[model samples]
Target: MADRETPGDAARSDRRPLDGIVVLDITRVVAGPFCAMLLADLGASVIKVEHPDDPDYARGFPPMVGGGDAGESAFFTQFNRNKRGISVNLKSPDGKELLKQLVRKADVLVENFRPGTMDKLGLGYDELRRCNPRLVYTAISGFGRTGPNSSRPAFDNTGQAVGGLWSMNGYADRPPVRVGTIIGDLAASLYATIGTLAALRTAEKTGEGQVVDVSQQDSILTLTENAVVRYTTRGEVASPLGNDHPFVRPYGQFPCKDGYVFFGGYTDKFWRLTCEMFGEPEVADDPEIDTMDKRFDPDVAERRVKPLLERWFSAYGKAELEAMAGDRVPLSAIKTIPEVVEDPHVAARNMIVEVPVGGETVRMVGSPIKLSMTGEIPLGAAPAPGQHTRSVLAELLGLDDEAIRRLAGSGAI
Candidate 1:
């Protein structure tokens, strides 16, 4: 995949692997926008298509770049970076025909509408494939294209609740909490990106494109891990452990003098090292919990290991404890948002990037996918509504100024 070539590789204007590919992003909010942004970062020419009059609601998301309601959404700016923007009235006949025209030249089309909305507009995958046989049709939905719940409109929290993720998140006694982040949308977006690239590869190889259906609920269900397997294999309905692992002892977050530190001294070797680091080497030789298997017993863990670790951990600060543990025990300070943004390790990895927007700079998390050839992905400011409509229409569809003016007049651009 890293070496795959496309039409304009001879010029090598963009050294990224996805150069010469074009993507039509017919999506809003999180999941779909994130998928398209990944493609854009990889050097694909992504055109974000929103409704002309009522554009993506994310444009109003707050903490606006220039402050108040005067400027663009910083939230929108982060996800939509490195993409051109267009607006189309998909409800109109002219808009439908215009989208079809753009489809013929596009390598991929990504949409996050409800199951049948595209079909109602007559721009569904079945219809679009007729316009371009090699176009990858990527769809992200709540439950999926085929299911009893397929038609339901879902947001991030909805996906988490329905997919059983919310039930497993918090302490067993307390009401469950949704994952701190928008894992439902983000996980689905990651899966959609993987599916799109795979389908794109098949399109290039066999000259045939296919549908990529990613459901947020399905994505969440896939991440349930040991809970699902435990139920199936042992009929054990897992309950929340409140930062505790199912089998490992001394492996969860512990309070230090200031802030918290995650400590993993479960393995016998690491446990011994941790004991030595605390100047309690005799504790490591305790016959009652000498081996890792013995330490897993509830009685031993509850009465012995937990108290020992907690007593030691409470005496030192997070950074001091982590430094003492070093590479011997897997220990690290739990960082806050500000701490993470200023982290030396994150800076060294180029994980945080700044994008210039409307004379202001919005700092954003950078793409994690790094290729040796494409060392750094250039960030483009998030576009105003329909900002690139005329350019995209003229370049891709070969529409002249008169035609562009007519489309704009009809509110179909």
Candidate 2:
């Protein structure tokens, strides 16, 4: 038997890709925190910079760990894991200077404020670039730095609506529905991370860093797949189709006796096999509905195939239907969050992990990116407000005990 490697082993080893990088996370809420956390997971020294008087607003979000006023928000803990936190009153001159000092030493600075917010504080990309030419400054905004509506405030729902995501979501008859999750914020975060990495690579070679402007709306639009292409090229506007796919038939969720099962068997062979499994071999052989085009035709499918398939699927239990599938077609029961957390495959992939926080164990979603060399990234608990303020000041800014105390007394930190 071989010894199993642990997250501790991975952390102590030099296999982490971003071992020496320092990231100044001056963002808040989901999008910014998510981006910084991703960098931290990859071994960057991410310092979550918060306002001294008021910490990240996500700390107040609901679903607290232990409940009551003292309990930490699970929402905050999930996104901010594996990052150190420091609070500095950016509005104060002393605090601004302290942040500038930290920024000079940082390789990357990520901020998600409305347009012109950083400029008002004299900490914009153009200003920071002067001090640290190699710093990758990423700004995640609602619209963008330069646009007609760039300055407008936007939340997750606003991004989804403005980006055409809502227009194409939900059933065609129902009102446009926002996605269950904050895809707008998450998508922007992923894009910001990518932009930061690319900028970092360029800075390493050329010693010149540029601003990476990521907009939530723009990010959401990018993820709309072929919605824009269909409109522009084919002159056909895409509409909501519930769980059904736009281009393929028998590629959506179907009801079973126990629960709903989703399957996608788009090809002719799989379709034939599906019909045979439903005890309708003659339907598969029917020349009128043989071809993909004919089968997917709205009138034909709505009147003949869909109802028949739905009835057949409704007759069988989920387990029975899964057995009948037998890998000939793609199929699975729609899993809830609880089911997902307990699933064997999720456990095998280390998608759920527990971290110790404030003397309590908190369960959180694990990092998805797996590196053979680095192994699993170490998961740590999110810091309390200004948790690392003193330590960070001492190490990064060379501030001693007296100076740190003075700054705290003056409300600068």
Candidate 3:
């Protein structure tokens, strides 16, 4: 073990929302790992358990700068920050015993394996819950824990397609489209985190732990805003309306001088204001276009307003239009990725953070959750494979040097 620290180290410890909490993260890929990262960011002592045969598959993805080995993928680094890594082959008896020992001291356990994978490894919730009665077990799955599609494979696109999000995207005339971002995976992960925190709160109150079952399909299902309402109340099986709102017209993406601006006039007042801003006050008087119901017709609204909107928006640039719109009618041009990176407001808000790694600086998005009392701490770069294995085994499991060496030699860790 490293030399012991004094009282000053304890006094200067980072204090955040989840301080004093310990999380054992036995998840990989996106959803489960993201939840663990969020907990770690809030001051949880998160120990990421990986297999000795291979680390998380995400560590081998592309978009790497140095073109090094599989351990340097940016996708893995971005989501797995602020946590410690250790190697453990759960198939081994020693490894299972080690994990049980860690679980006795853990507050939460997160996993994202197939339904029966964990049980095969003997670390299923039923077995592990017995090891620690207060351990919060979070299981993130594909369709769900039990169902017809529960055993099927799933990815972000699969979830999006199954959840009705893709059917509602794109223009009404074109084919259904999937969102560019991995929203399905991200949403599931975020909901998993929320569920974990809720379970943690309940555990504290009741002095018992519970299982949090997160389904990617279920998470994606939650994103179908008005689609469900329209289907249930009006028998409206929604199709692609493109950038326009399904329930409101004149609320879609429109062409600007340089790029495109999204105009969202969801209400009658906003619709009127949109017409006024574009010097098309006659639209506000037309019985066919005045009311919210009439204005919601894409054909009617587009025909009556597109030309006037184009002429008005063409006269001024994006900045001028944005300034004139002034959040009254909700108008702003769609920006590219580079533009988003250089946006002044984004910089001002510290959304893009610069960090030093490999003796150079790399830019990435900062953590969105900002606490007033506990300021953001500087996190170091991702470690190499098995970088902290010896230290973690020594500190948490109280394994001596001989034991660690024996485990490493026998391929048990």
Candidate 4:
């Protein structure tokens, strides 16, 4: 805790890639916060704008710093790291003017409110572009800003169900299941981040800013990739095949003595190697099962090859199976979360980092992007609500103490 740099201190440093850029983050919860946090990690000065009376609801979410009702949420802290915070009641006239002032100096602005919410408040992209023509304005929502369902409220599950992900997940016999993680919201955030960066580049070059409209459904649909192509071209509907691959035999998870191990023997060479490793060389040599197409046949794979490999795998432990197959076969043991956190590779790559929170240290997932020139990005603590209201107003808006006091008295800070 003592060694970690504060967000303000980090923002003052010059070595970051987005060092001089200022981001006005008027978003709450996962999708929007995740996107802004990435920019912050890359060295942007991100200012999280919250309501004067009610801040981001995630601030009170579970897994708090202390084991009480009043503690700060670690979940919120993890996503909002490396950002300053300010509170402003946008419904108030003073607050609106304050935001407009901030917009004049900001390089980027991000929000995830449903379509028309910002427009009603006079803070939409069309309006803000007038303040700063070079501002990169991004909006993330469930269905995007120009669709029939643009105003429909959605969360992670809604995106998964509407985008066809739930239909293709889980076992064929079971009900459709949402993925374990909030991939819907997270994926939209990732796509929005990419769109924002690209828009920023264009804005910098042409001195013109544009709106980046990102939809959770659209982002999830893009991940369907080959499934959509296969359905449209072959008139085939994909169903959950458990861990099995649709086009290859012996390309799924196998139950070992202790746990499950994934083996992808998709290529002919790997198929033969897997057979040899499983002590079933005869299966590899048989003319009926030699080629990929023959081995991929449902009846052949299910009744003949699968049973033999299952029996062989059931006799060995996961580690023994991995060692036997070695690098020749694409074998992996399905590790749990704790195992992954303690893994040697993860440590070496710095994928787990410790940050200060509430006078203590908490570990969170680190950024994956590595830059040669910028080096390691600093991870800073998330700020308290309106923590920098006075300082930011003075520094950016050139407001004196009297002005700041007046704004605060009027409930507009």
In TM-score terms, which candidate is top? 1
Query: Which pairs clash (backbone N, Cα, C closer than 3 Å) in model 3?
Result: 170-242, 171-242
Which candidate number maximizes lDDT? 1
RMSD of each: 4.3, 3.1, 6.3, 4.9
Question: Could you arrange the candidates by lDDT from highest to lowest?
Answer: 1, 4, 2, 3
Q: For model 2, what is the alpha-carbon lDDT of residue 5?
A: 72
lDDT tens digits, residue span 7-56, model 1: 54455444788999999999999999999999999999999998988999
Tens digit of lDDT per residue, candidate 3, span 187-258?
Answer: 989999999999999999987999898988999889988888888999999788766666566676777777
Q: Model 4 scores what on Cα lDDT?
A: 0.88
> Lowest-lDDT window of 10 residues in candidate 2?
6-15
What are the runs in model 4 whose C-alpha is more than 4 Å off?
1-14, 279-282
The TM-score measured for candidate 4 stands at 0.93
lDDT of 4 by residue, 1-413 (tens): 56654356533544888889999999999989999999999999999999978999999877778655447778998899999999999989899989999999999999999999999998888888889999999999999999799999999898998898888888999987788999998999999999999999998899999999999999988876578988999988877777877787778888889999887876789888888887777778888778888888999888877887789889998878878878788988788888789988799778989987766789889999866555678889998999998888899989999999999898887
What stretches of model 3 exceed 4 Å from their correct place? 1-14, 69-71, 275-283, 286-288, 356-359
Give candidate 1 misplaced runs (Cα > 4 Å): 1-14
Worst 10 residues of 4 by lDDT: 5-14
State the lDDT at 69 in candidate 4.
48
Query: TM-score of each candidate?
Result: 0.95, 0.93, 0.91, 0.93
Give the TM-score comparing model 2 with the true structure, all chains together: 0.93
In model 2, the runs with Cα more than 4 Å from the true position are 1-14, 67-69, 276-282
